[model samples]
Target: MSVYTQLTNDQFATFCQSFGVSFVRAIPITQGIKNSNWFIQTTDDVDGAYSYVLTLFEERPPADIEKMAVILNQLDGKLPVAAPLSVIESNSVQTDDDDKRYVIHYEDKAITLVPCLAGSHPEQTTQAMCHDIGAALAMLHETLQALQPAEQYGVPLYPWADVRDREMQFMPGDEAKLMSDIWRSYTELPLTTLPNGLCHLDMFADNTLWNLQKGEEHLTGLLDFTEVSVEHYVMDIAITINDFCTTWGMAEQGESVNFDRSKMAAFLQGYESKRALGLDEKRALPVMLAKAAVIFWLLRLNVIHYNRTEGRTGDNIMVKNPDLMKRLAAYHWAHVEKSQNTVFVLSGTTSDNQIIGVFSSITQAEQAREKLSNSSEFAIKEYTLDQLS
Candidate 1:
């Protein structure tokens, strides 16, 4: 009952044949959000055996497919991540007899077949993993900064920001109002200025695969670059912190969870190990984290929730609660308040003073009205005023 289109076994075999991969067997891998994925096993006549992941992009536009491919191509060597192989030359993917192209389908969705990464995702986030993730992110951010802006691929540091704004407009009642208020708070905050580059916007825990060979979890590869865009480094940092440090559900339940400040520090340490964040970038972490929370909330509300309402259900996906949006806002605000020094407030001296003065005047006026109400002449004057006026 997944909303995404599924490729039949025969059609999948033909698709693999087109890419010179003679498929022996194919099994669906149910671990993605926006696409239907399958692990296709191919007989390697000379090499022995191999498997590749066929990602049938459901509900994704061709423009997004091309944009991700182009960005991934640019980021291939820069970070430890997976990039889709080009079936046809010049960033265009091929299709089977069913008219399914490598990155586009007849159903107006994008599809791509990627080499299956040979690592398992860690069940829990550890300090070592956090450090590696931090370093990986930092390295990725550095690489992105070195590259040119990819406006075609929608590469703003806060790409989801735009999406959230659109979704808030359509949501109902208090939910929509709360979303709007959080978005306004983010907009009002001064943003960090950093060099723009390609960003892997969806680097959550599930997207990361780990290799635990040496009794220590090492980051094997980063997966799912569908949300790749051009954005600031802090935005990525904010997302990492929100995903790894703040969310309790991500950690083992009933473990007496504490916000691993050391893990947080380790992540920052790794990031700085590659390229140092500027003063503005470091300062903007709390606001960026708040923005990240709001962004994820809206994404769940609009994309996941809407899909569920349309009857899309699967092993890996579920509709997010609307109430969680308020909780997320509160969490972000608490963090932002604690880290206010890092946040850039956009109010000027004159504007700030005027606001304070207005509040003071309102307080004084309320006190004067209360004093007048307690006086005996107050009722007489009110009656006289009513008669005269």
Candidate 2:
């Protein structure tokens, strides 16, 4: 939502008139990183004033943008999504032959107008907010289940997969290996059997709006559907949890990162209130959390890389620190390990039926027992985590 492209007032007024309204003014919205966004004000005889968000497709292809617009239209009344306003007449390549939904062509790019939603971006998150977001996310997925896979909609699946190899070329060996290891763990999961649907892969706090003016705060809108994709339900849940449950700090300040268990519980409970999660999804949450962190780490690095290589330096260009995500990935992995390490002890006749070793995961404990020479008499003694839960 940066002002990458500058447009004259007259040019904007002409565009506004195409929608049958007179443009009052336009203000650049410089909060996001991907596209050029503006808060546009228009007026008509019937309505004195009205506001809308104008977005120019900066990086995404025109085809993908159209699909996103259609998706928003489909989800508008159900969710607080900003559905694109249809053009009165076809001005550009028609998005659909039977439908009047169209995007204006501007310099070989697409532009869209959507209603400016109420409320402001929340500065901080609470358990109530997390709960509300979780229920909303579940509703989104459930509603999207009727649509076909992302490929049918011309949307990419697992967007980060396209840039992983290229981004690794620029990463340090340690960071690259960390990324690969976590990614490998995620791929090894039973993803094919897990529940599948379109996911709001980016559900950060700022991407949502809340009615802070009222005594009771509630979510009023969900913004930025650019990162939507077809993926496992657990992966989406993990991505949302990574942002909502984690406490972040400025990378320059070297503050510590922490995850709030209570917030996570509330989010899960809220999600369960709408739709129950499968056992496989429950088991995959820990590693999926780590995987989600890696994706964002890669995204931040990609943004920084392009900003330097493409000479896109400006106050309007918002570049987040990649180090914070790197630290977050490490924290998630450690948390997974800590949760997995339930002190599994291997006993076998080879060691006179005594304890042989302690392991974190069940697979690691089984592998250790297989390595023993006299494995037939071996038995694995697992410690119960009755207190932790």
Candidate 3:
């Protein structure tokens, strides 16, 4: 609920006129954390009705917003993302630009408008819904392949280092130490080999709107592209799985967060339905989970530390409990390096065959699988159990 800049109806009407969209009424959208948003109900010259989300980009740099517009432009027709609308030309007819500011100045802040995709965020995220979002994300990642990765398209890692250097005020000492440990181990992961590309790093349920149906799930609207960036796809996967699949009631701020393993499997299956996850990706996922946890932990902490007076008046701030992320980070870090893998030997042509035995490590599992790969009509595979259930 961050609306740092306010606009009057007359001001909004003038702004809408530039885009050849008439302003009917405006309602402030206060669900977002980073930027100020408003649902503008508009009427064209012909009395045609439409709605758009007007966003004043805060926190992020102007250049990042430019690249974000480019990404949204590329994904306009391919996915359910709410892309920004261009301002009508001086003639008030056609509007086109290559790399100009689709973003305009409002109170010296960069702002843009996008069509409001219709759908409500699910009250309770179903396994089927998780599956739908997983596939949608993969499709989004696939379509985003066309865009070149740029510096501003990613959240820089150096900030983590800076965050570490800052003196702790409210954070528990042991929790802070655990976070440092995870970040240290995260840097040692095989980051170079993992699939890296443009990712919607933040895919929590609220960011997505769904077409809800009995025994069916459909993704209708994907919002808040501000957090999209260039990063390892597995990291994105980890972030989504943690947010969507995990559901324990918020007892306090962050006390009851728990990951559901069945939903995790279902989500991975759905993701693989569009794009396959390789063994390298699988192996790196645990640490990537830790990385996702740390990133969000630091992000929330940074926000709370800086914007202390965010929601003191009208609306309450949706402060995501950093402790929950901290807890998950420590959990993943503990399991990531554990020596717990199982080797499987298959009969016939199917992968659902027989597990030979549980090996202590992936290396040992590989050795056992290799010994039987040459056996008469048998397939071999290694499955790492990076403890998440």
Candidate 4:
């Protein structure tokens, strides 16, 4: 991510020696917010100039870093993962005795060197690219099915409660309520029935690399597995769709964000080509999309909070706008209400109360409630098809 720990070129050159490469240059990459990254250039006798990405883990523990390295290694040939280069065993003599196979310790921080992937991050996403990414993501999920359990790798579940207590509490009343509503909607879904596996939670276009050829863009690489964890497949899909299928800066036109349905369809088509989604996952998608947006909104807000309180400031620190994500979350909820695909069940408060009527639209359910006796209180409960199951 961002350049938090500054390193001199001489320091970089010294570090690169362990990998048996002559360091040419180390340029700070100032795009992300989690770790410190550098675009390193190295010279070899056979390959004059080759590029690699040098990453310095700013916050992760050694075990976390090691797990990431192992995961990347597992996915290396199967996908275009940026697998870290193993430290030359002979070079261990030059460094410390507590040597890792792929990772090195420098300045008490975990560091890794991965070959720079070819192609550039797509400036704009296309349907074809969406399809490719979706298919690739699905394939990635299937490939990791045989891997050990999430806990075995020390991968933690999504911190829904943590975000609610830490970030949402400090948010404005309206925004906090929106978050709570969306979270409740998500929690009510049949989450256990949804497919689960390793998921790249952050699959934004910028995290992927693409190459343009003959007017069509093809996915060349998928970058950044730092946020990868064991999560619902639908959750991963929702996160990806929120990014690839969303058009930013449309607030001036009217809506805060616009969802390109055609692109979303193409992406799902590609995903289904590799692995089909259960009907439950499809039904849960709308709410999950809103939930995904809320998570990112809170994440960005958290970043801003730390940057201000922790006093992390510099040209290398890149902070994304949280308001955009908040607006997107609102738009998703509006979309859900307007679509009216969810079922509404109306019931009375009496002890002998039974399900009176199930309506497709909330308006219809409200009308039915109005016609009923006002003496017995009524409540409209929303449910997705999966929830009924």
Please tell me which predicted candidate would have the highest lDDT against the true structure.
4
Off by over 4 Å in 3: 44-50, 92-101, 149-158, 167-170, 251-255, 309-316, 337-389
TM-score of 1: 0.72
TM-score of 3: 0.81
lDDT of each: 0.61, 0.78, 0.72, 0.80
lDDT of 3 at 148: 62
In candidate 2, stretches whose alpha carbon ends up further than 4 angstroms from where it belongs are 44-50, 90-98, 213-215, 250-256, 343-389
Question: How do all models score by TM-score?
Answer: 0.72, 0.82, 0.81, 0.82
lDDT of 2 at 259: 75
After TM-score superposition, the amount by which residue 320's alpha carbon in candidate 1 deviates from its true location, in angstroms, is 5.1
lDDT of 4 by residue, 17-77 (tens): 7766679888788887888998887764234445788989887765677787777877889
lDDT of 3 by residue, 1-389 (tens): 46656789998888877656778887777775678778788764235435787888877766667678888888888888887877666754443467345777765566788888878887678878877888888998898887665454554533566775563545578877777777777788787888888888889888998888777668888888777778889989999987897774666643776766556656776787899887788767767777888888887777777676444334634456677777777766666655335433333344665556554434234334434645444444445555443
lDDT for model 3 comes to 0.72
